[model samples]
Target: MDIIEQAAKRLEELRRAGVEVAPEPQPSVGETARKVGAGSTAPADAQGVAQSRRVELDMNVLTAHGILTPDSVRSQLGDEMRVIKRPLLHNVSGKGAAPVKDANLIMVTSALPGEGKTFMAANLAISIAMELDHTVLLVDADVARPSLPEVFGFDEERGLLDVLTDPTLDLSQVLLRTNIEKLSVLPAGTPHPRATELLASEAMNHLLADMAQRYHDRIIIFDSPPLLVTTEARALAMHMGQVVLVVKAESTTHAEVRNAIAAIESCPVKMAVLNKTTGHVDGHGYGYGYGYGYGYAAKSSASAART
Candidate 1:
């Protein structure tokens, strides 16, 4: 089964098992103010320009979903993400030998639908947002089938595309600031028939450049579409400094991964994560693997796979 099929199957299991999905969370006025820089005593060297809009996130919602928490250093998933985010963080701080242009922009994608690409993207964003020195903008660039709103339980239609299609739309207006001080979201906006063209346009290029360079301490992460399924993924990949390809264990074939990587070969840095692995000893649930690799010949083996 592809990622989407597997996800559907899991949802079915959850339904049969009577798992109670929580209702959408409601953030209080004070909570919203705190997340968007209001009611805060913290000193600011903040973004030079003043921002007028802020969208607060509910921590209860996030934690219930198994995402990183403020004290995420203790969870198993947190441990995994901390290790996964190390190199990305280094590249973000200009600590890499071959610093990539727009290195702060990271793309999370998969060879096909049904791999855990979106899961990887969301977790990575939450993980990086935990950093004291970094703020994260997780953009839902999967224009064809945006899932972030569902993932975060956010009910909104205005986001990234709204800004791109209309010059008058203020980015801050569309940007959603969460209570997680360091994390924000730019939704895919209303879907467009010309998503690929829009992504490939000069306006999109300028928007990415502005996001990357505007805030020196911010990292932009895109939850892009599956590479083989959409031209939009490649278009977004062209603008990324790093690409994390999510390869599902036992499901994604070697040839499929090669082709997906080939699709975004222009990216200076690339990493492959082996998702949904059942390899763990001593009754531990899942043991995620990590790697720093380059080129097509890096590794085609299963034993060393990590995601």
Candidate 2:
């Protein structure tokens, strides 16, 4: 059976077993768009269907927050992100050391809060979106404490959870297309009590499959919760082909990093980004930089580091 059919069957089984699915809504496209704060001037793609609502991201605000913008001049942060995204893009193109099942589905998380996972996720998405051959969808998967709306200066609307809960909600309806042609943002939707369950459900699997296969050059970055702080991140990590763990240099404890890595052990490709590392550059004054290590090399380095 196809993915959609398999997902439908599994959802039916769950419903029969007493799972609480959201009641189907019969709202028209316009009503649905208005309800989600998606404006009326929805652009149409090649298929002639209305595309996602277009939202303008403030360039000045993004610059102030150190976010990578399409038109921004090159900087240390952009250079770091380019280095960090190389292997990831290689994996996505099936050019890595080994093939990954859903290399396009990448989750960014940390061992603890305030470790810069969201920042990393955003930068990575922007960097990939700037790629000549790629498009990116940045999903705010941190349902408990989402930051994408604030970071991007966009209003919160129905998104990932909404699509998962309401079968009637199409992913395209809730997606927020940004001024940057290649970048799109998916809000964390209305918070739900059973968010962990929703993320781990069969519906999520199907949605991810659709998202990964929708465009060959599309890369989806999920800003997930801290692995050690919430069960939600672990649930989301289970299906991610690559897990990017952001570690705060001189802040996160060794044991915490170890435990966090263990939580997402099932992920095929695990990468660690050492954030906020202060060091000298070319005899220049000390400045912050990002350090990158891939797969087991990163894990081993983290294990050997002293807290």
Candidate 3:
């Protein structure tokens, strides 16, 4: 089947599965031709034009995965995320304890794999996008192993690496605007043999600077690789003003946490998120908890108790 047919089939499947799929907006003929010429080969149909410019995020899938959606009901996860994002937002708005350069650029990472860093990243992005004044760009920077496609259910497309490697490519061409108003996503893009080198390259620095200044009200969240497992996360951290480290409760060792914090020591603001906690908070089972610290102070105060 062609692109439009495939999209129709997918929407049908989502509908069959009881997902409330929103009707896609139709773009003008001129707009469709512009997108088609830009790189998208989708047919000149409403669905095709919509698919080229926007993606319909499945609310049911988000809920099933324990992610906070725009229409998500009030719950412990929502409450916890609010608390976790408050300080980060403060820094972004220049209201924190200290002024943070490029405070809008935030990276979410972990010391090791399987620590729920990606999960935290997605939730944080979604939470931030719900804000009234700020918009969010969720970039999948884990080049070697991107998971945002799976998390958001959007097909993999050209993104961060592609822009850095190809001088001809523009960030606007690869950015996928989602149905969620205020949220857009940049996929990991075509993987390269020198992904690590590309992320640290001067080209990457230029792209980051452009992204940081492109929209004054925009916050860019990078779901980066594990700091201890790969060099990419550390390289990305060098450009990020704030970093959120995900620490699995009762699983991630204190030594590992310390090392992870040390890896991103160059970041102006560092925060720790205690994930997968087993306990009841406010009469609800806890899935996430957080601790805020900056610099070496996090190393001393960051601790998780066994349930």
Q: Each candidate: what lDDT?
A: 0.71, 0.77, 0.76
Runs in model 3 deviating more than 4 A are 1-52, 280-307
How does model 2 fare in lDDT?
A: 0.77
Per-model TM-score on C-alpha atoms: 0.74, 0.81, 0.76
**Model 2: residues with Cα > 4 Å off, grouped in runs:** 1-22, 25-50, 280-307
Score residue 305 of candidate 2 by CA lDDT: 17
Clashing pairs in 2: none
Best by lDDT: 2
TM-score-better candidate, 2 vs 3: 2
Query: Which candidate gets the maximum TM-score versus the true structure?
Result: 2
Residue pairs of candidate 1 with colliding backbone atoms = 3-114, 4-114, 274-306, 274-307, 289-306
Model 1 scores a C-alpha lDDT of 0.71
- 1-307: candidate 3 lDDT, tens digit per residue: 4646645654554454344445778799999899667965543444333232578898776665656789877865677777888899999999988899999999999999887888788888999899888899999999898888877877888888776654444577678899888999999998777777677665566578778886557899999999998987888899898999989767899999999998998998898887765654235344443222111111111222211
Ranking by TM-score: 2, 3, 1
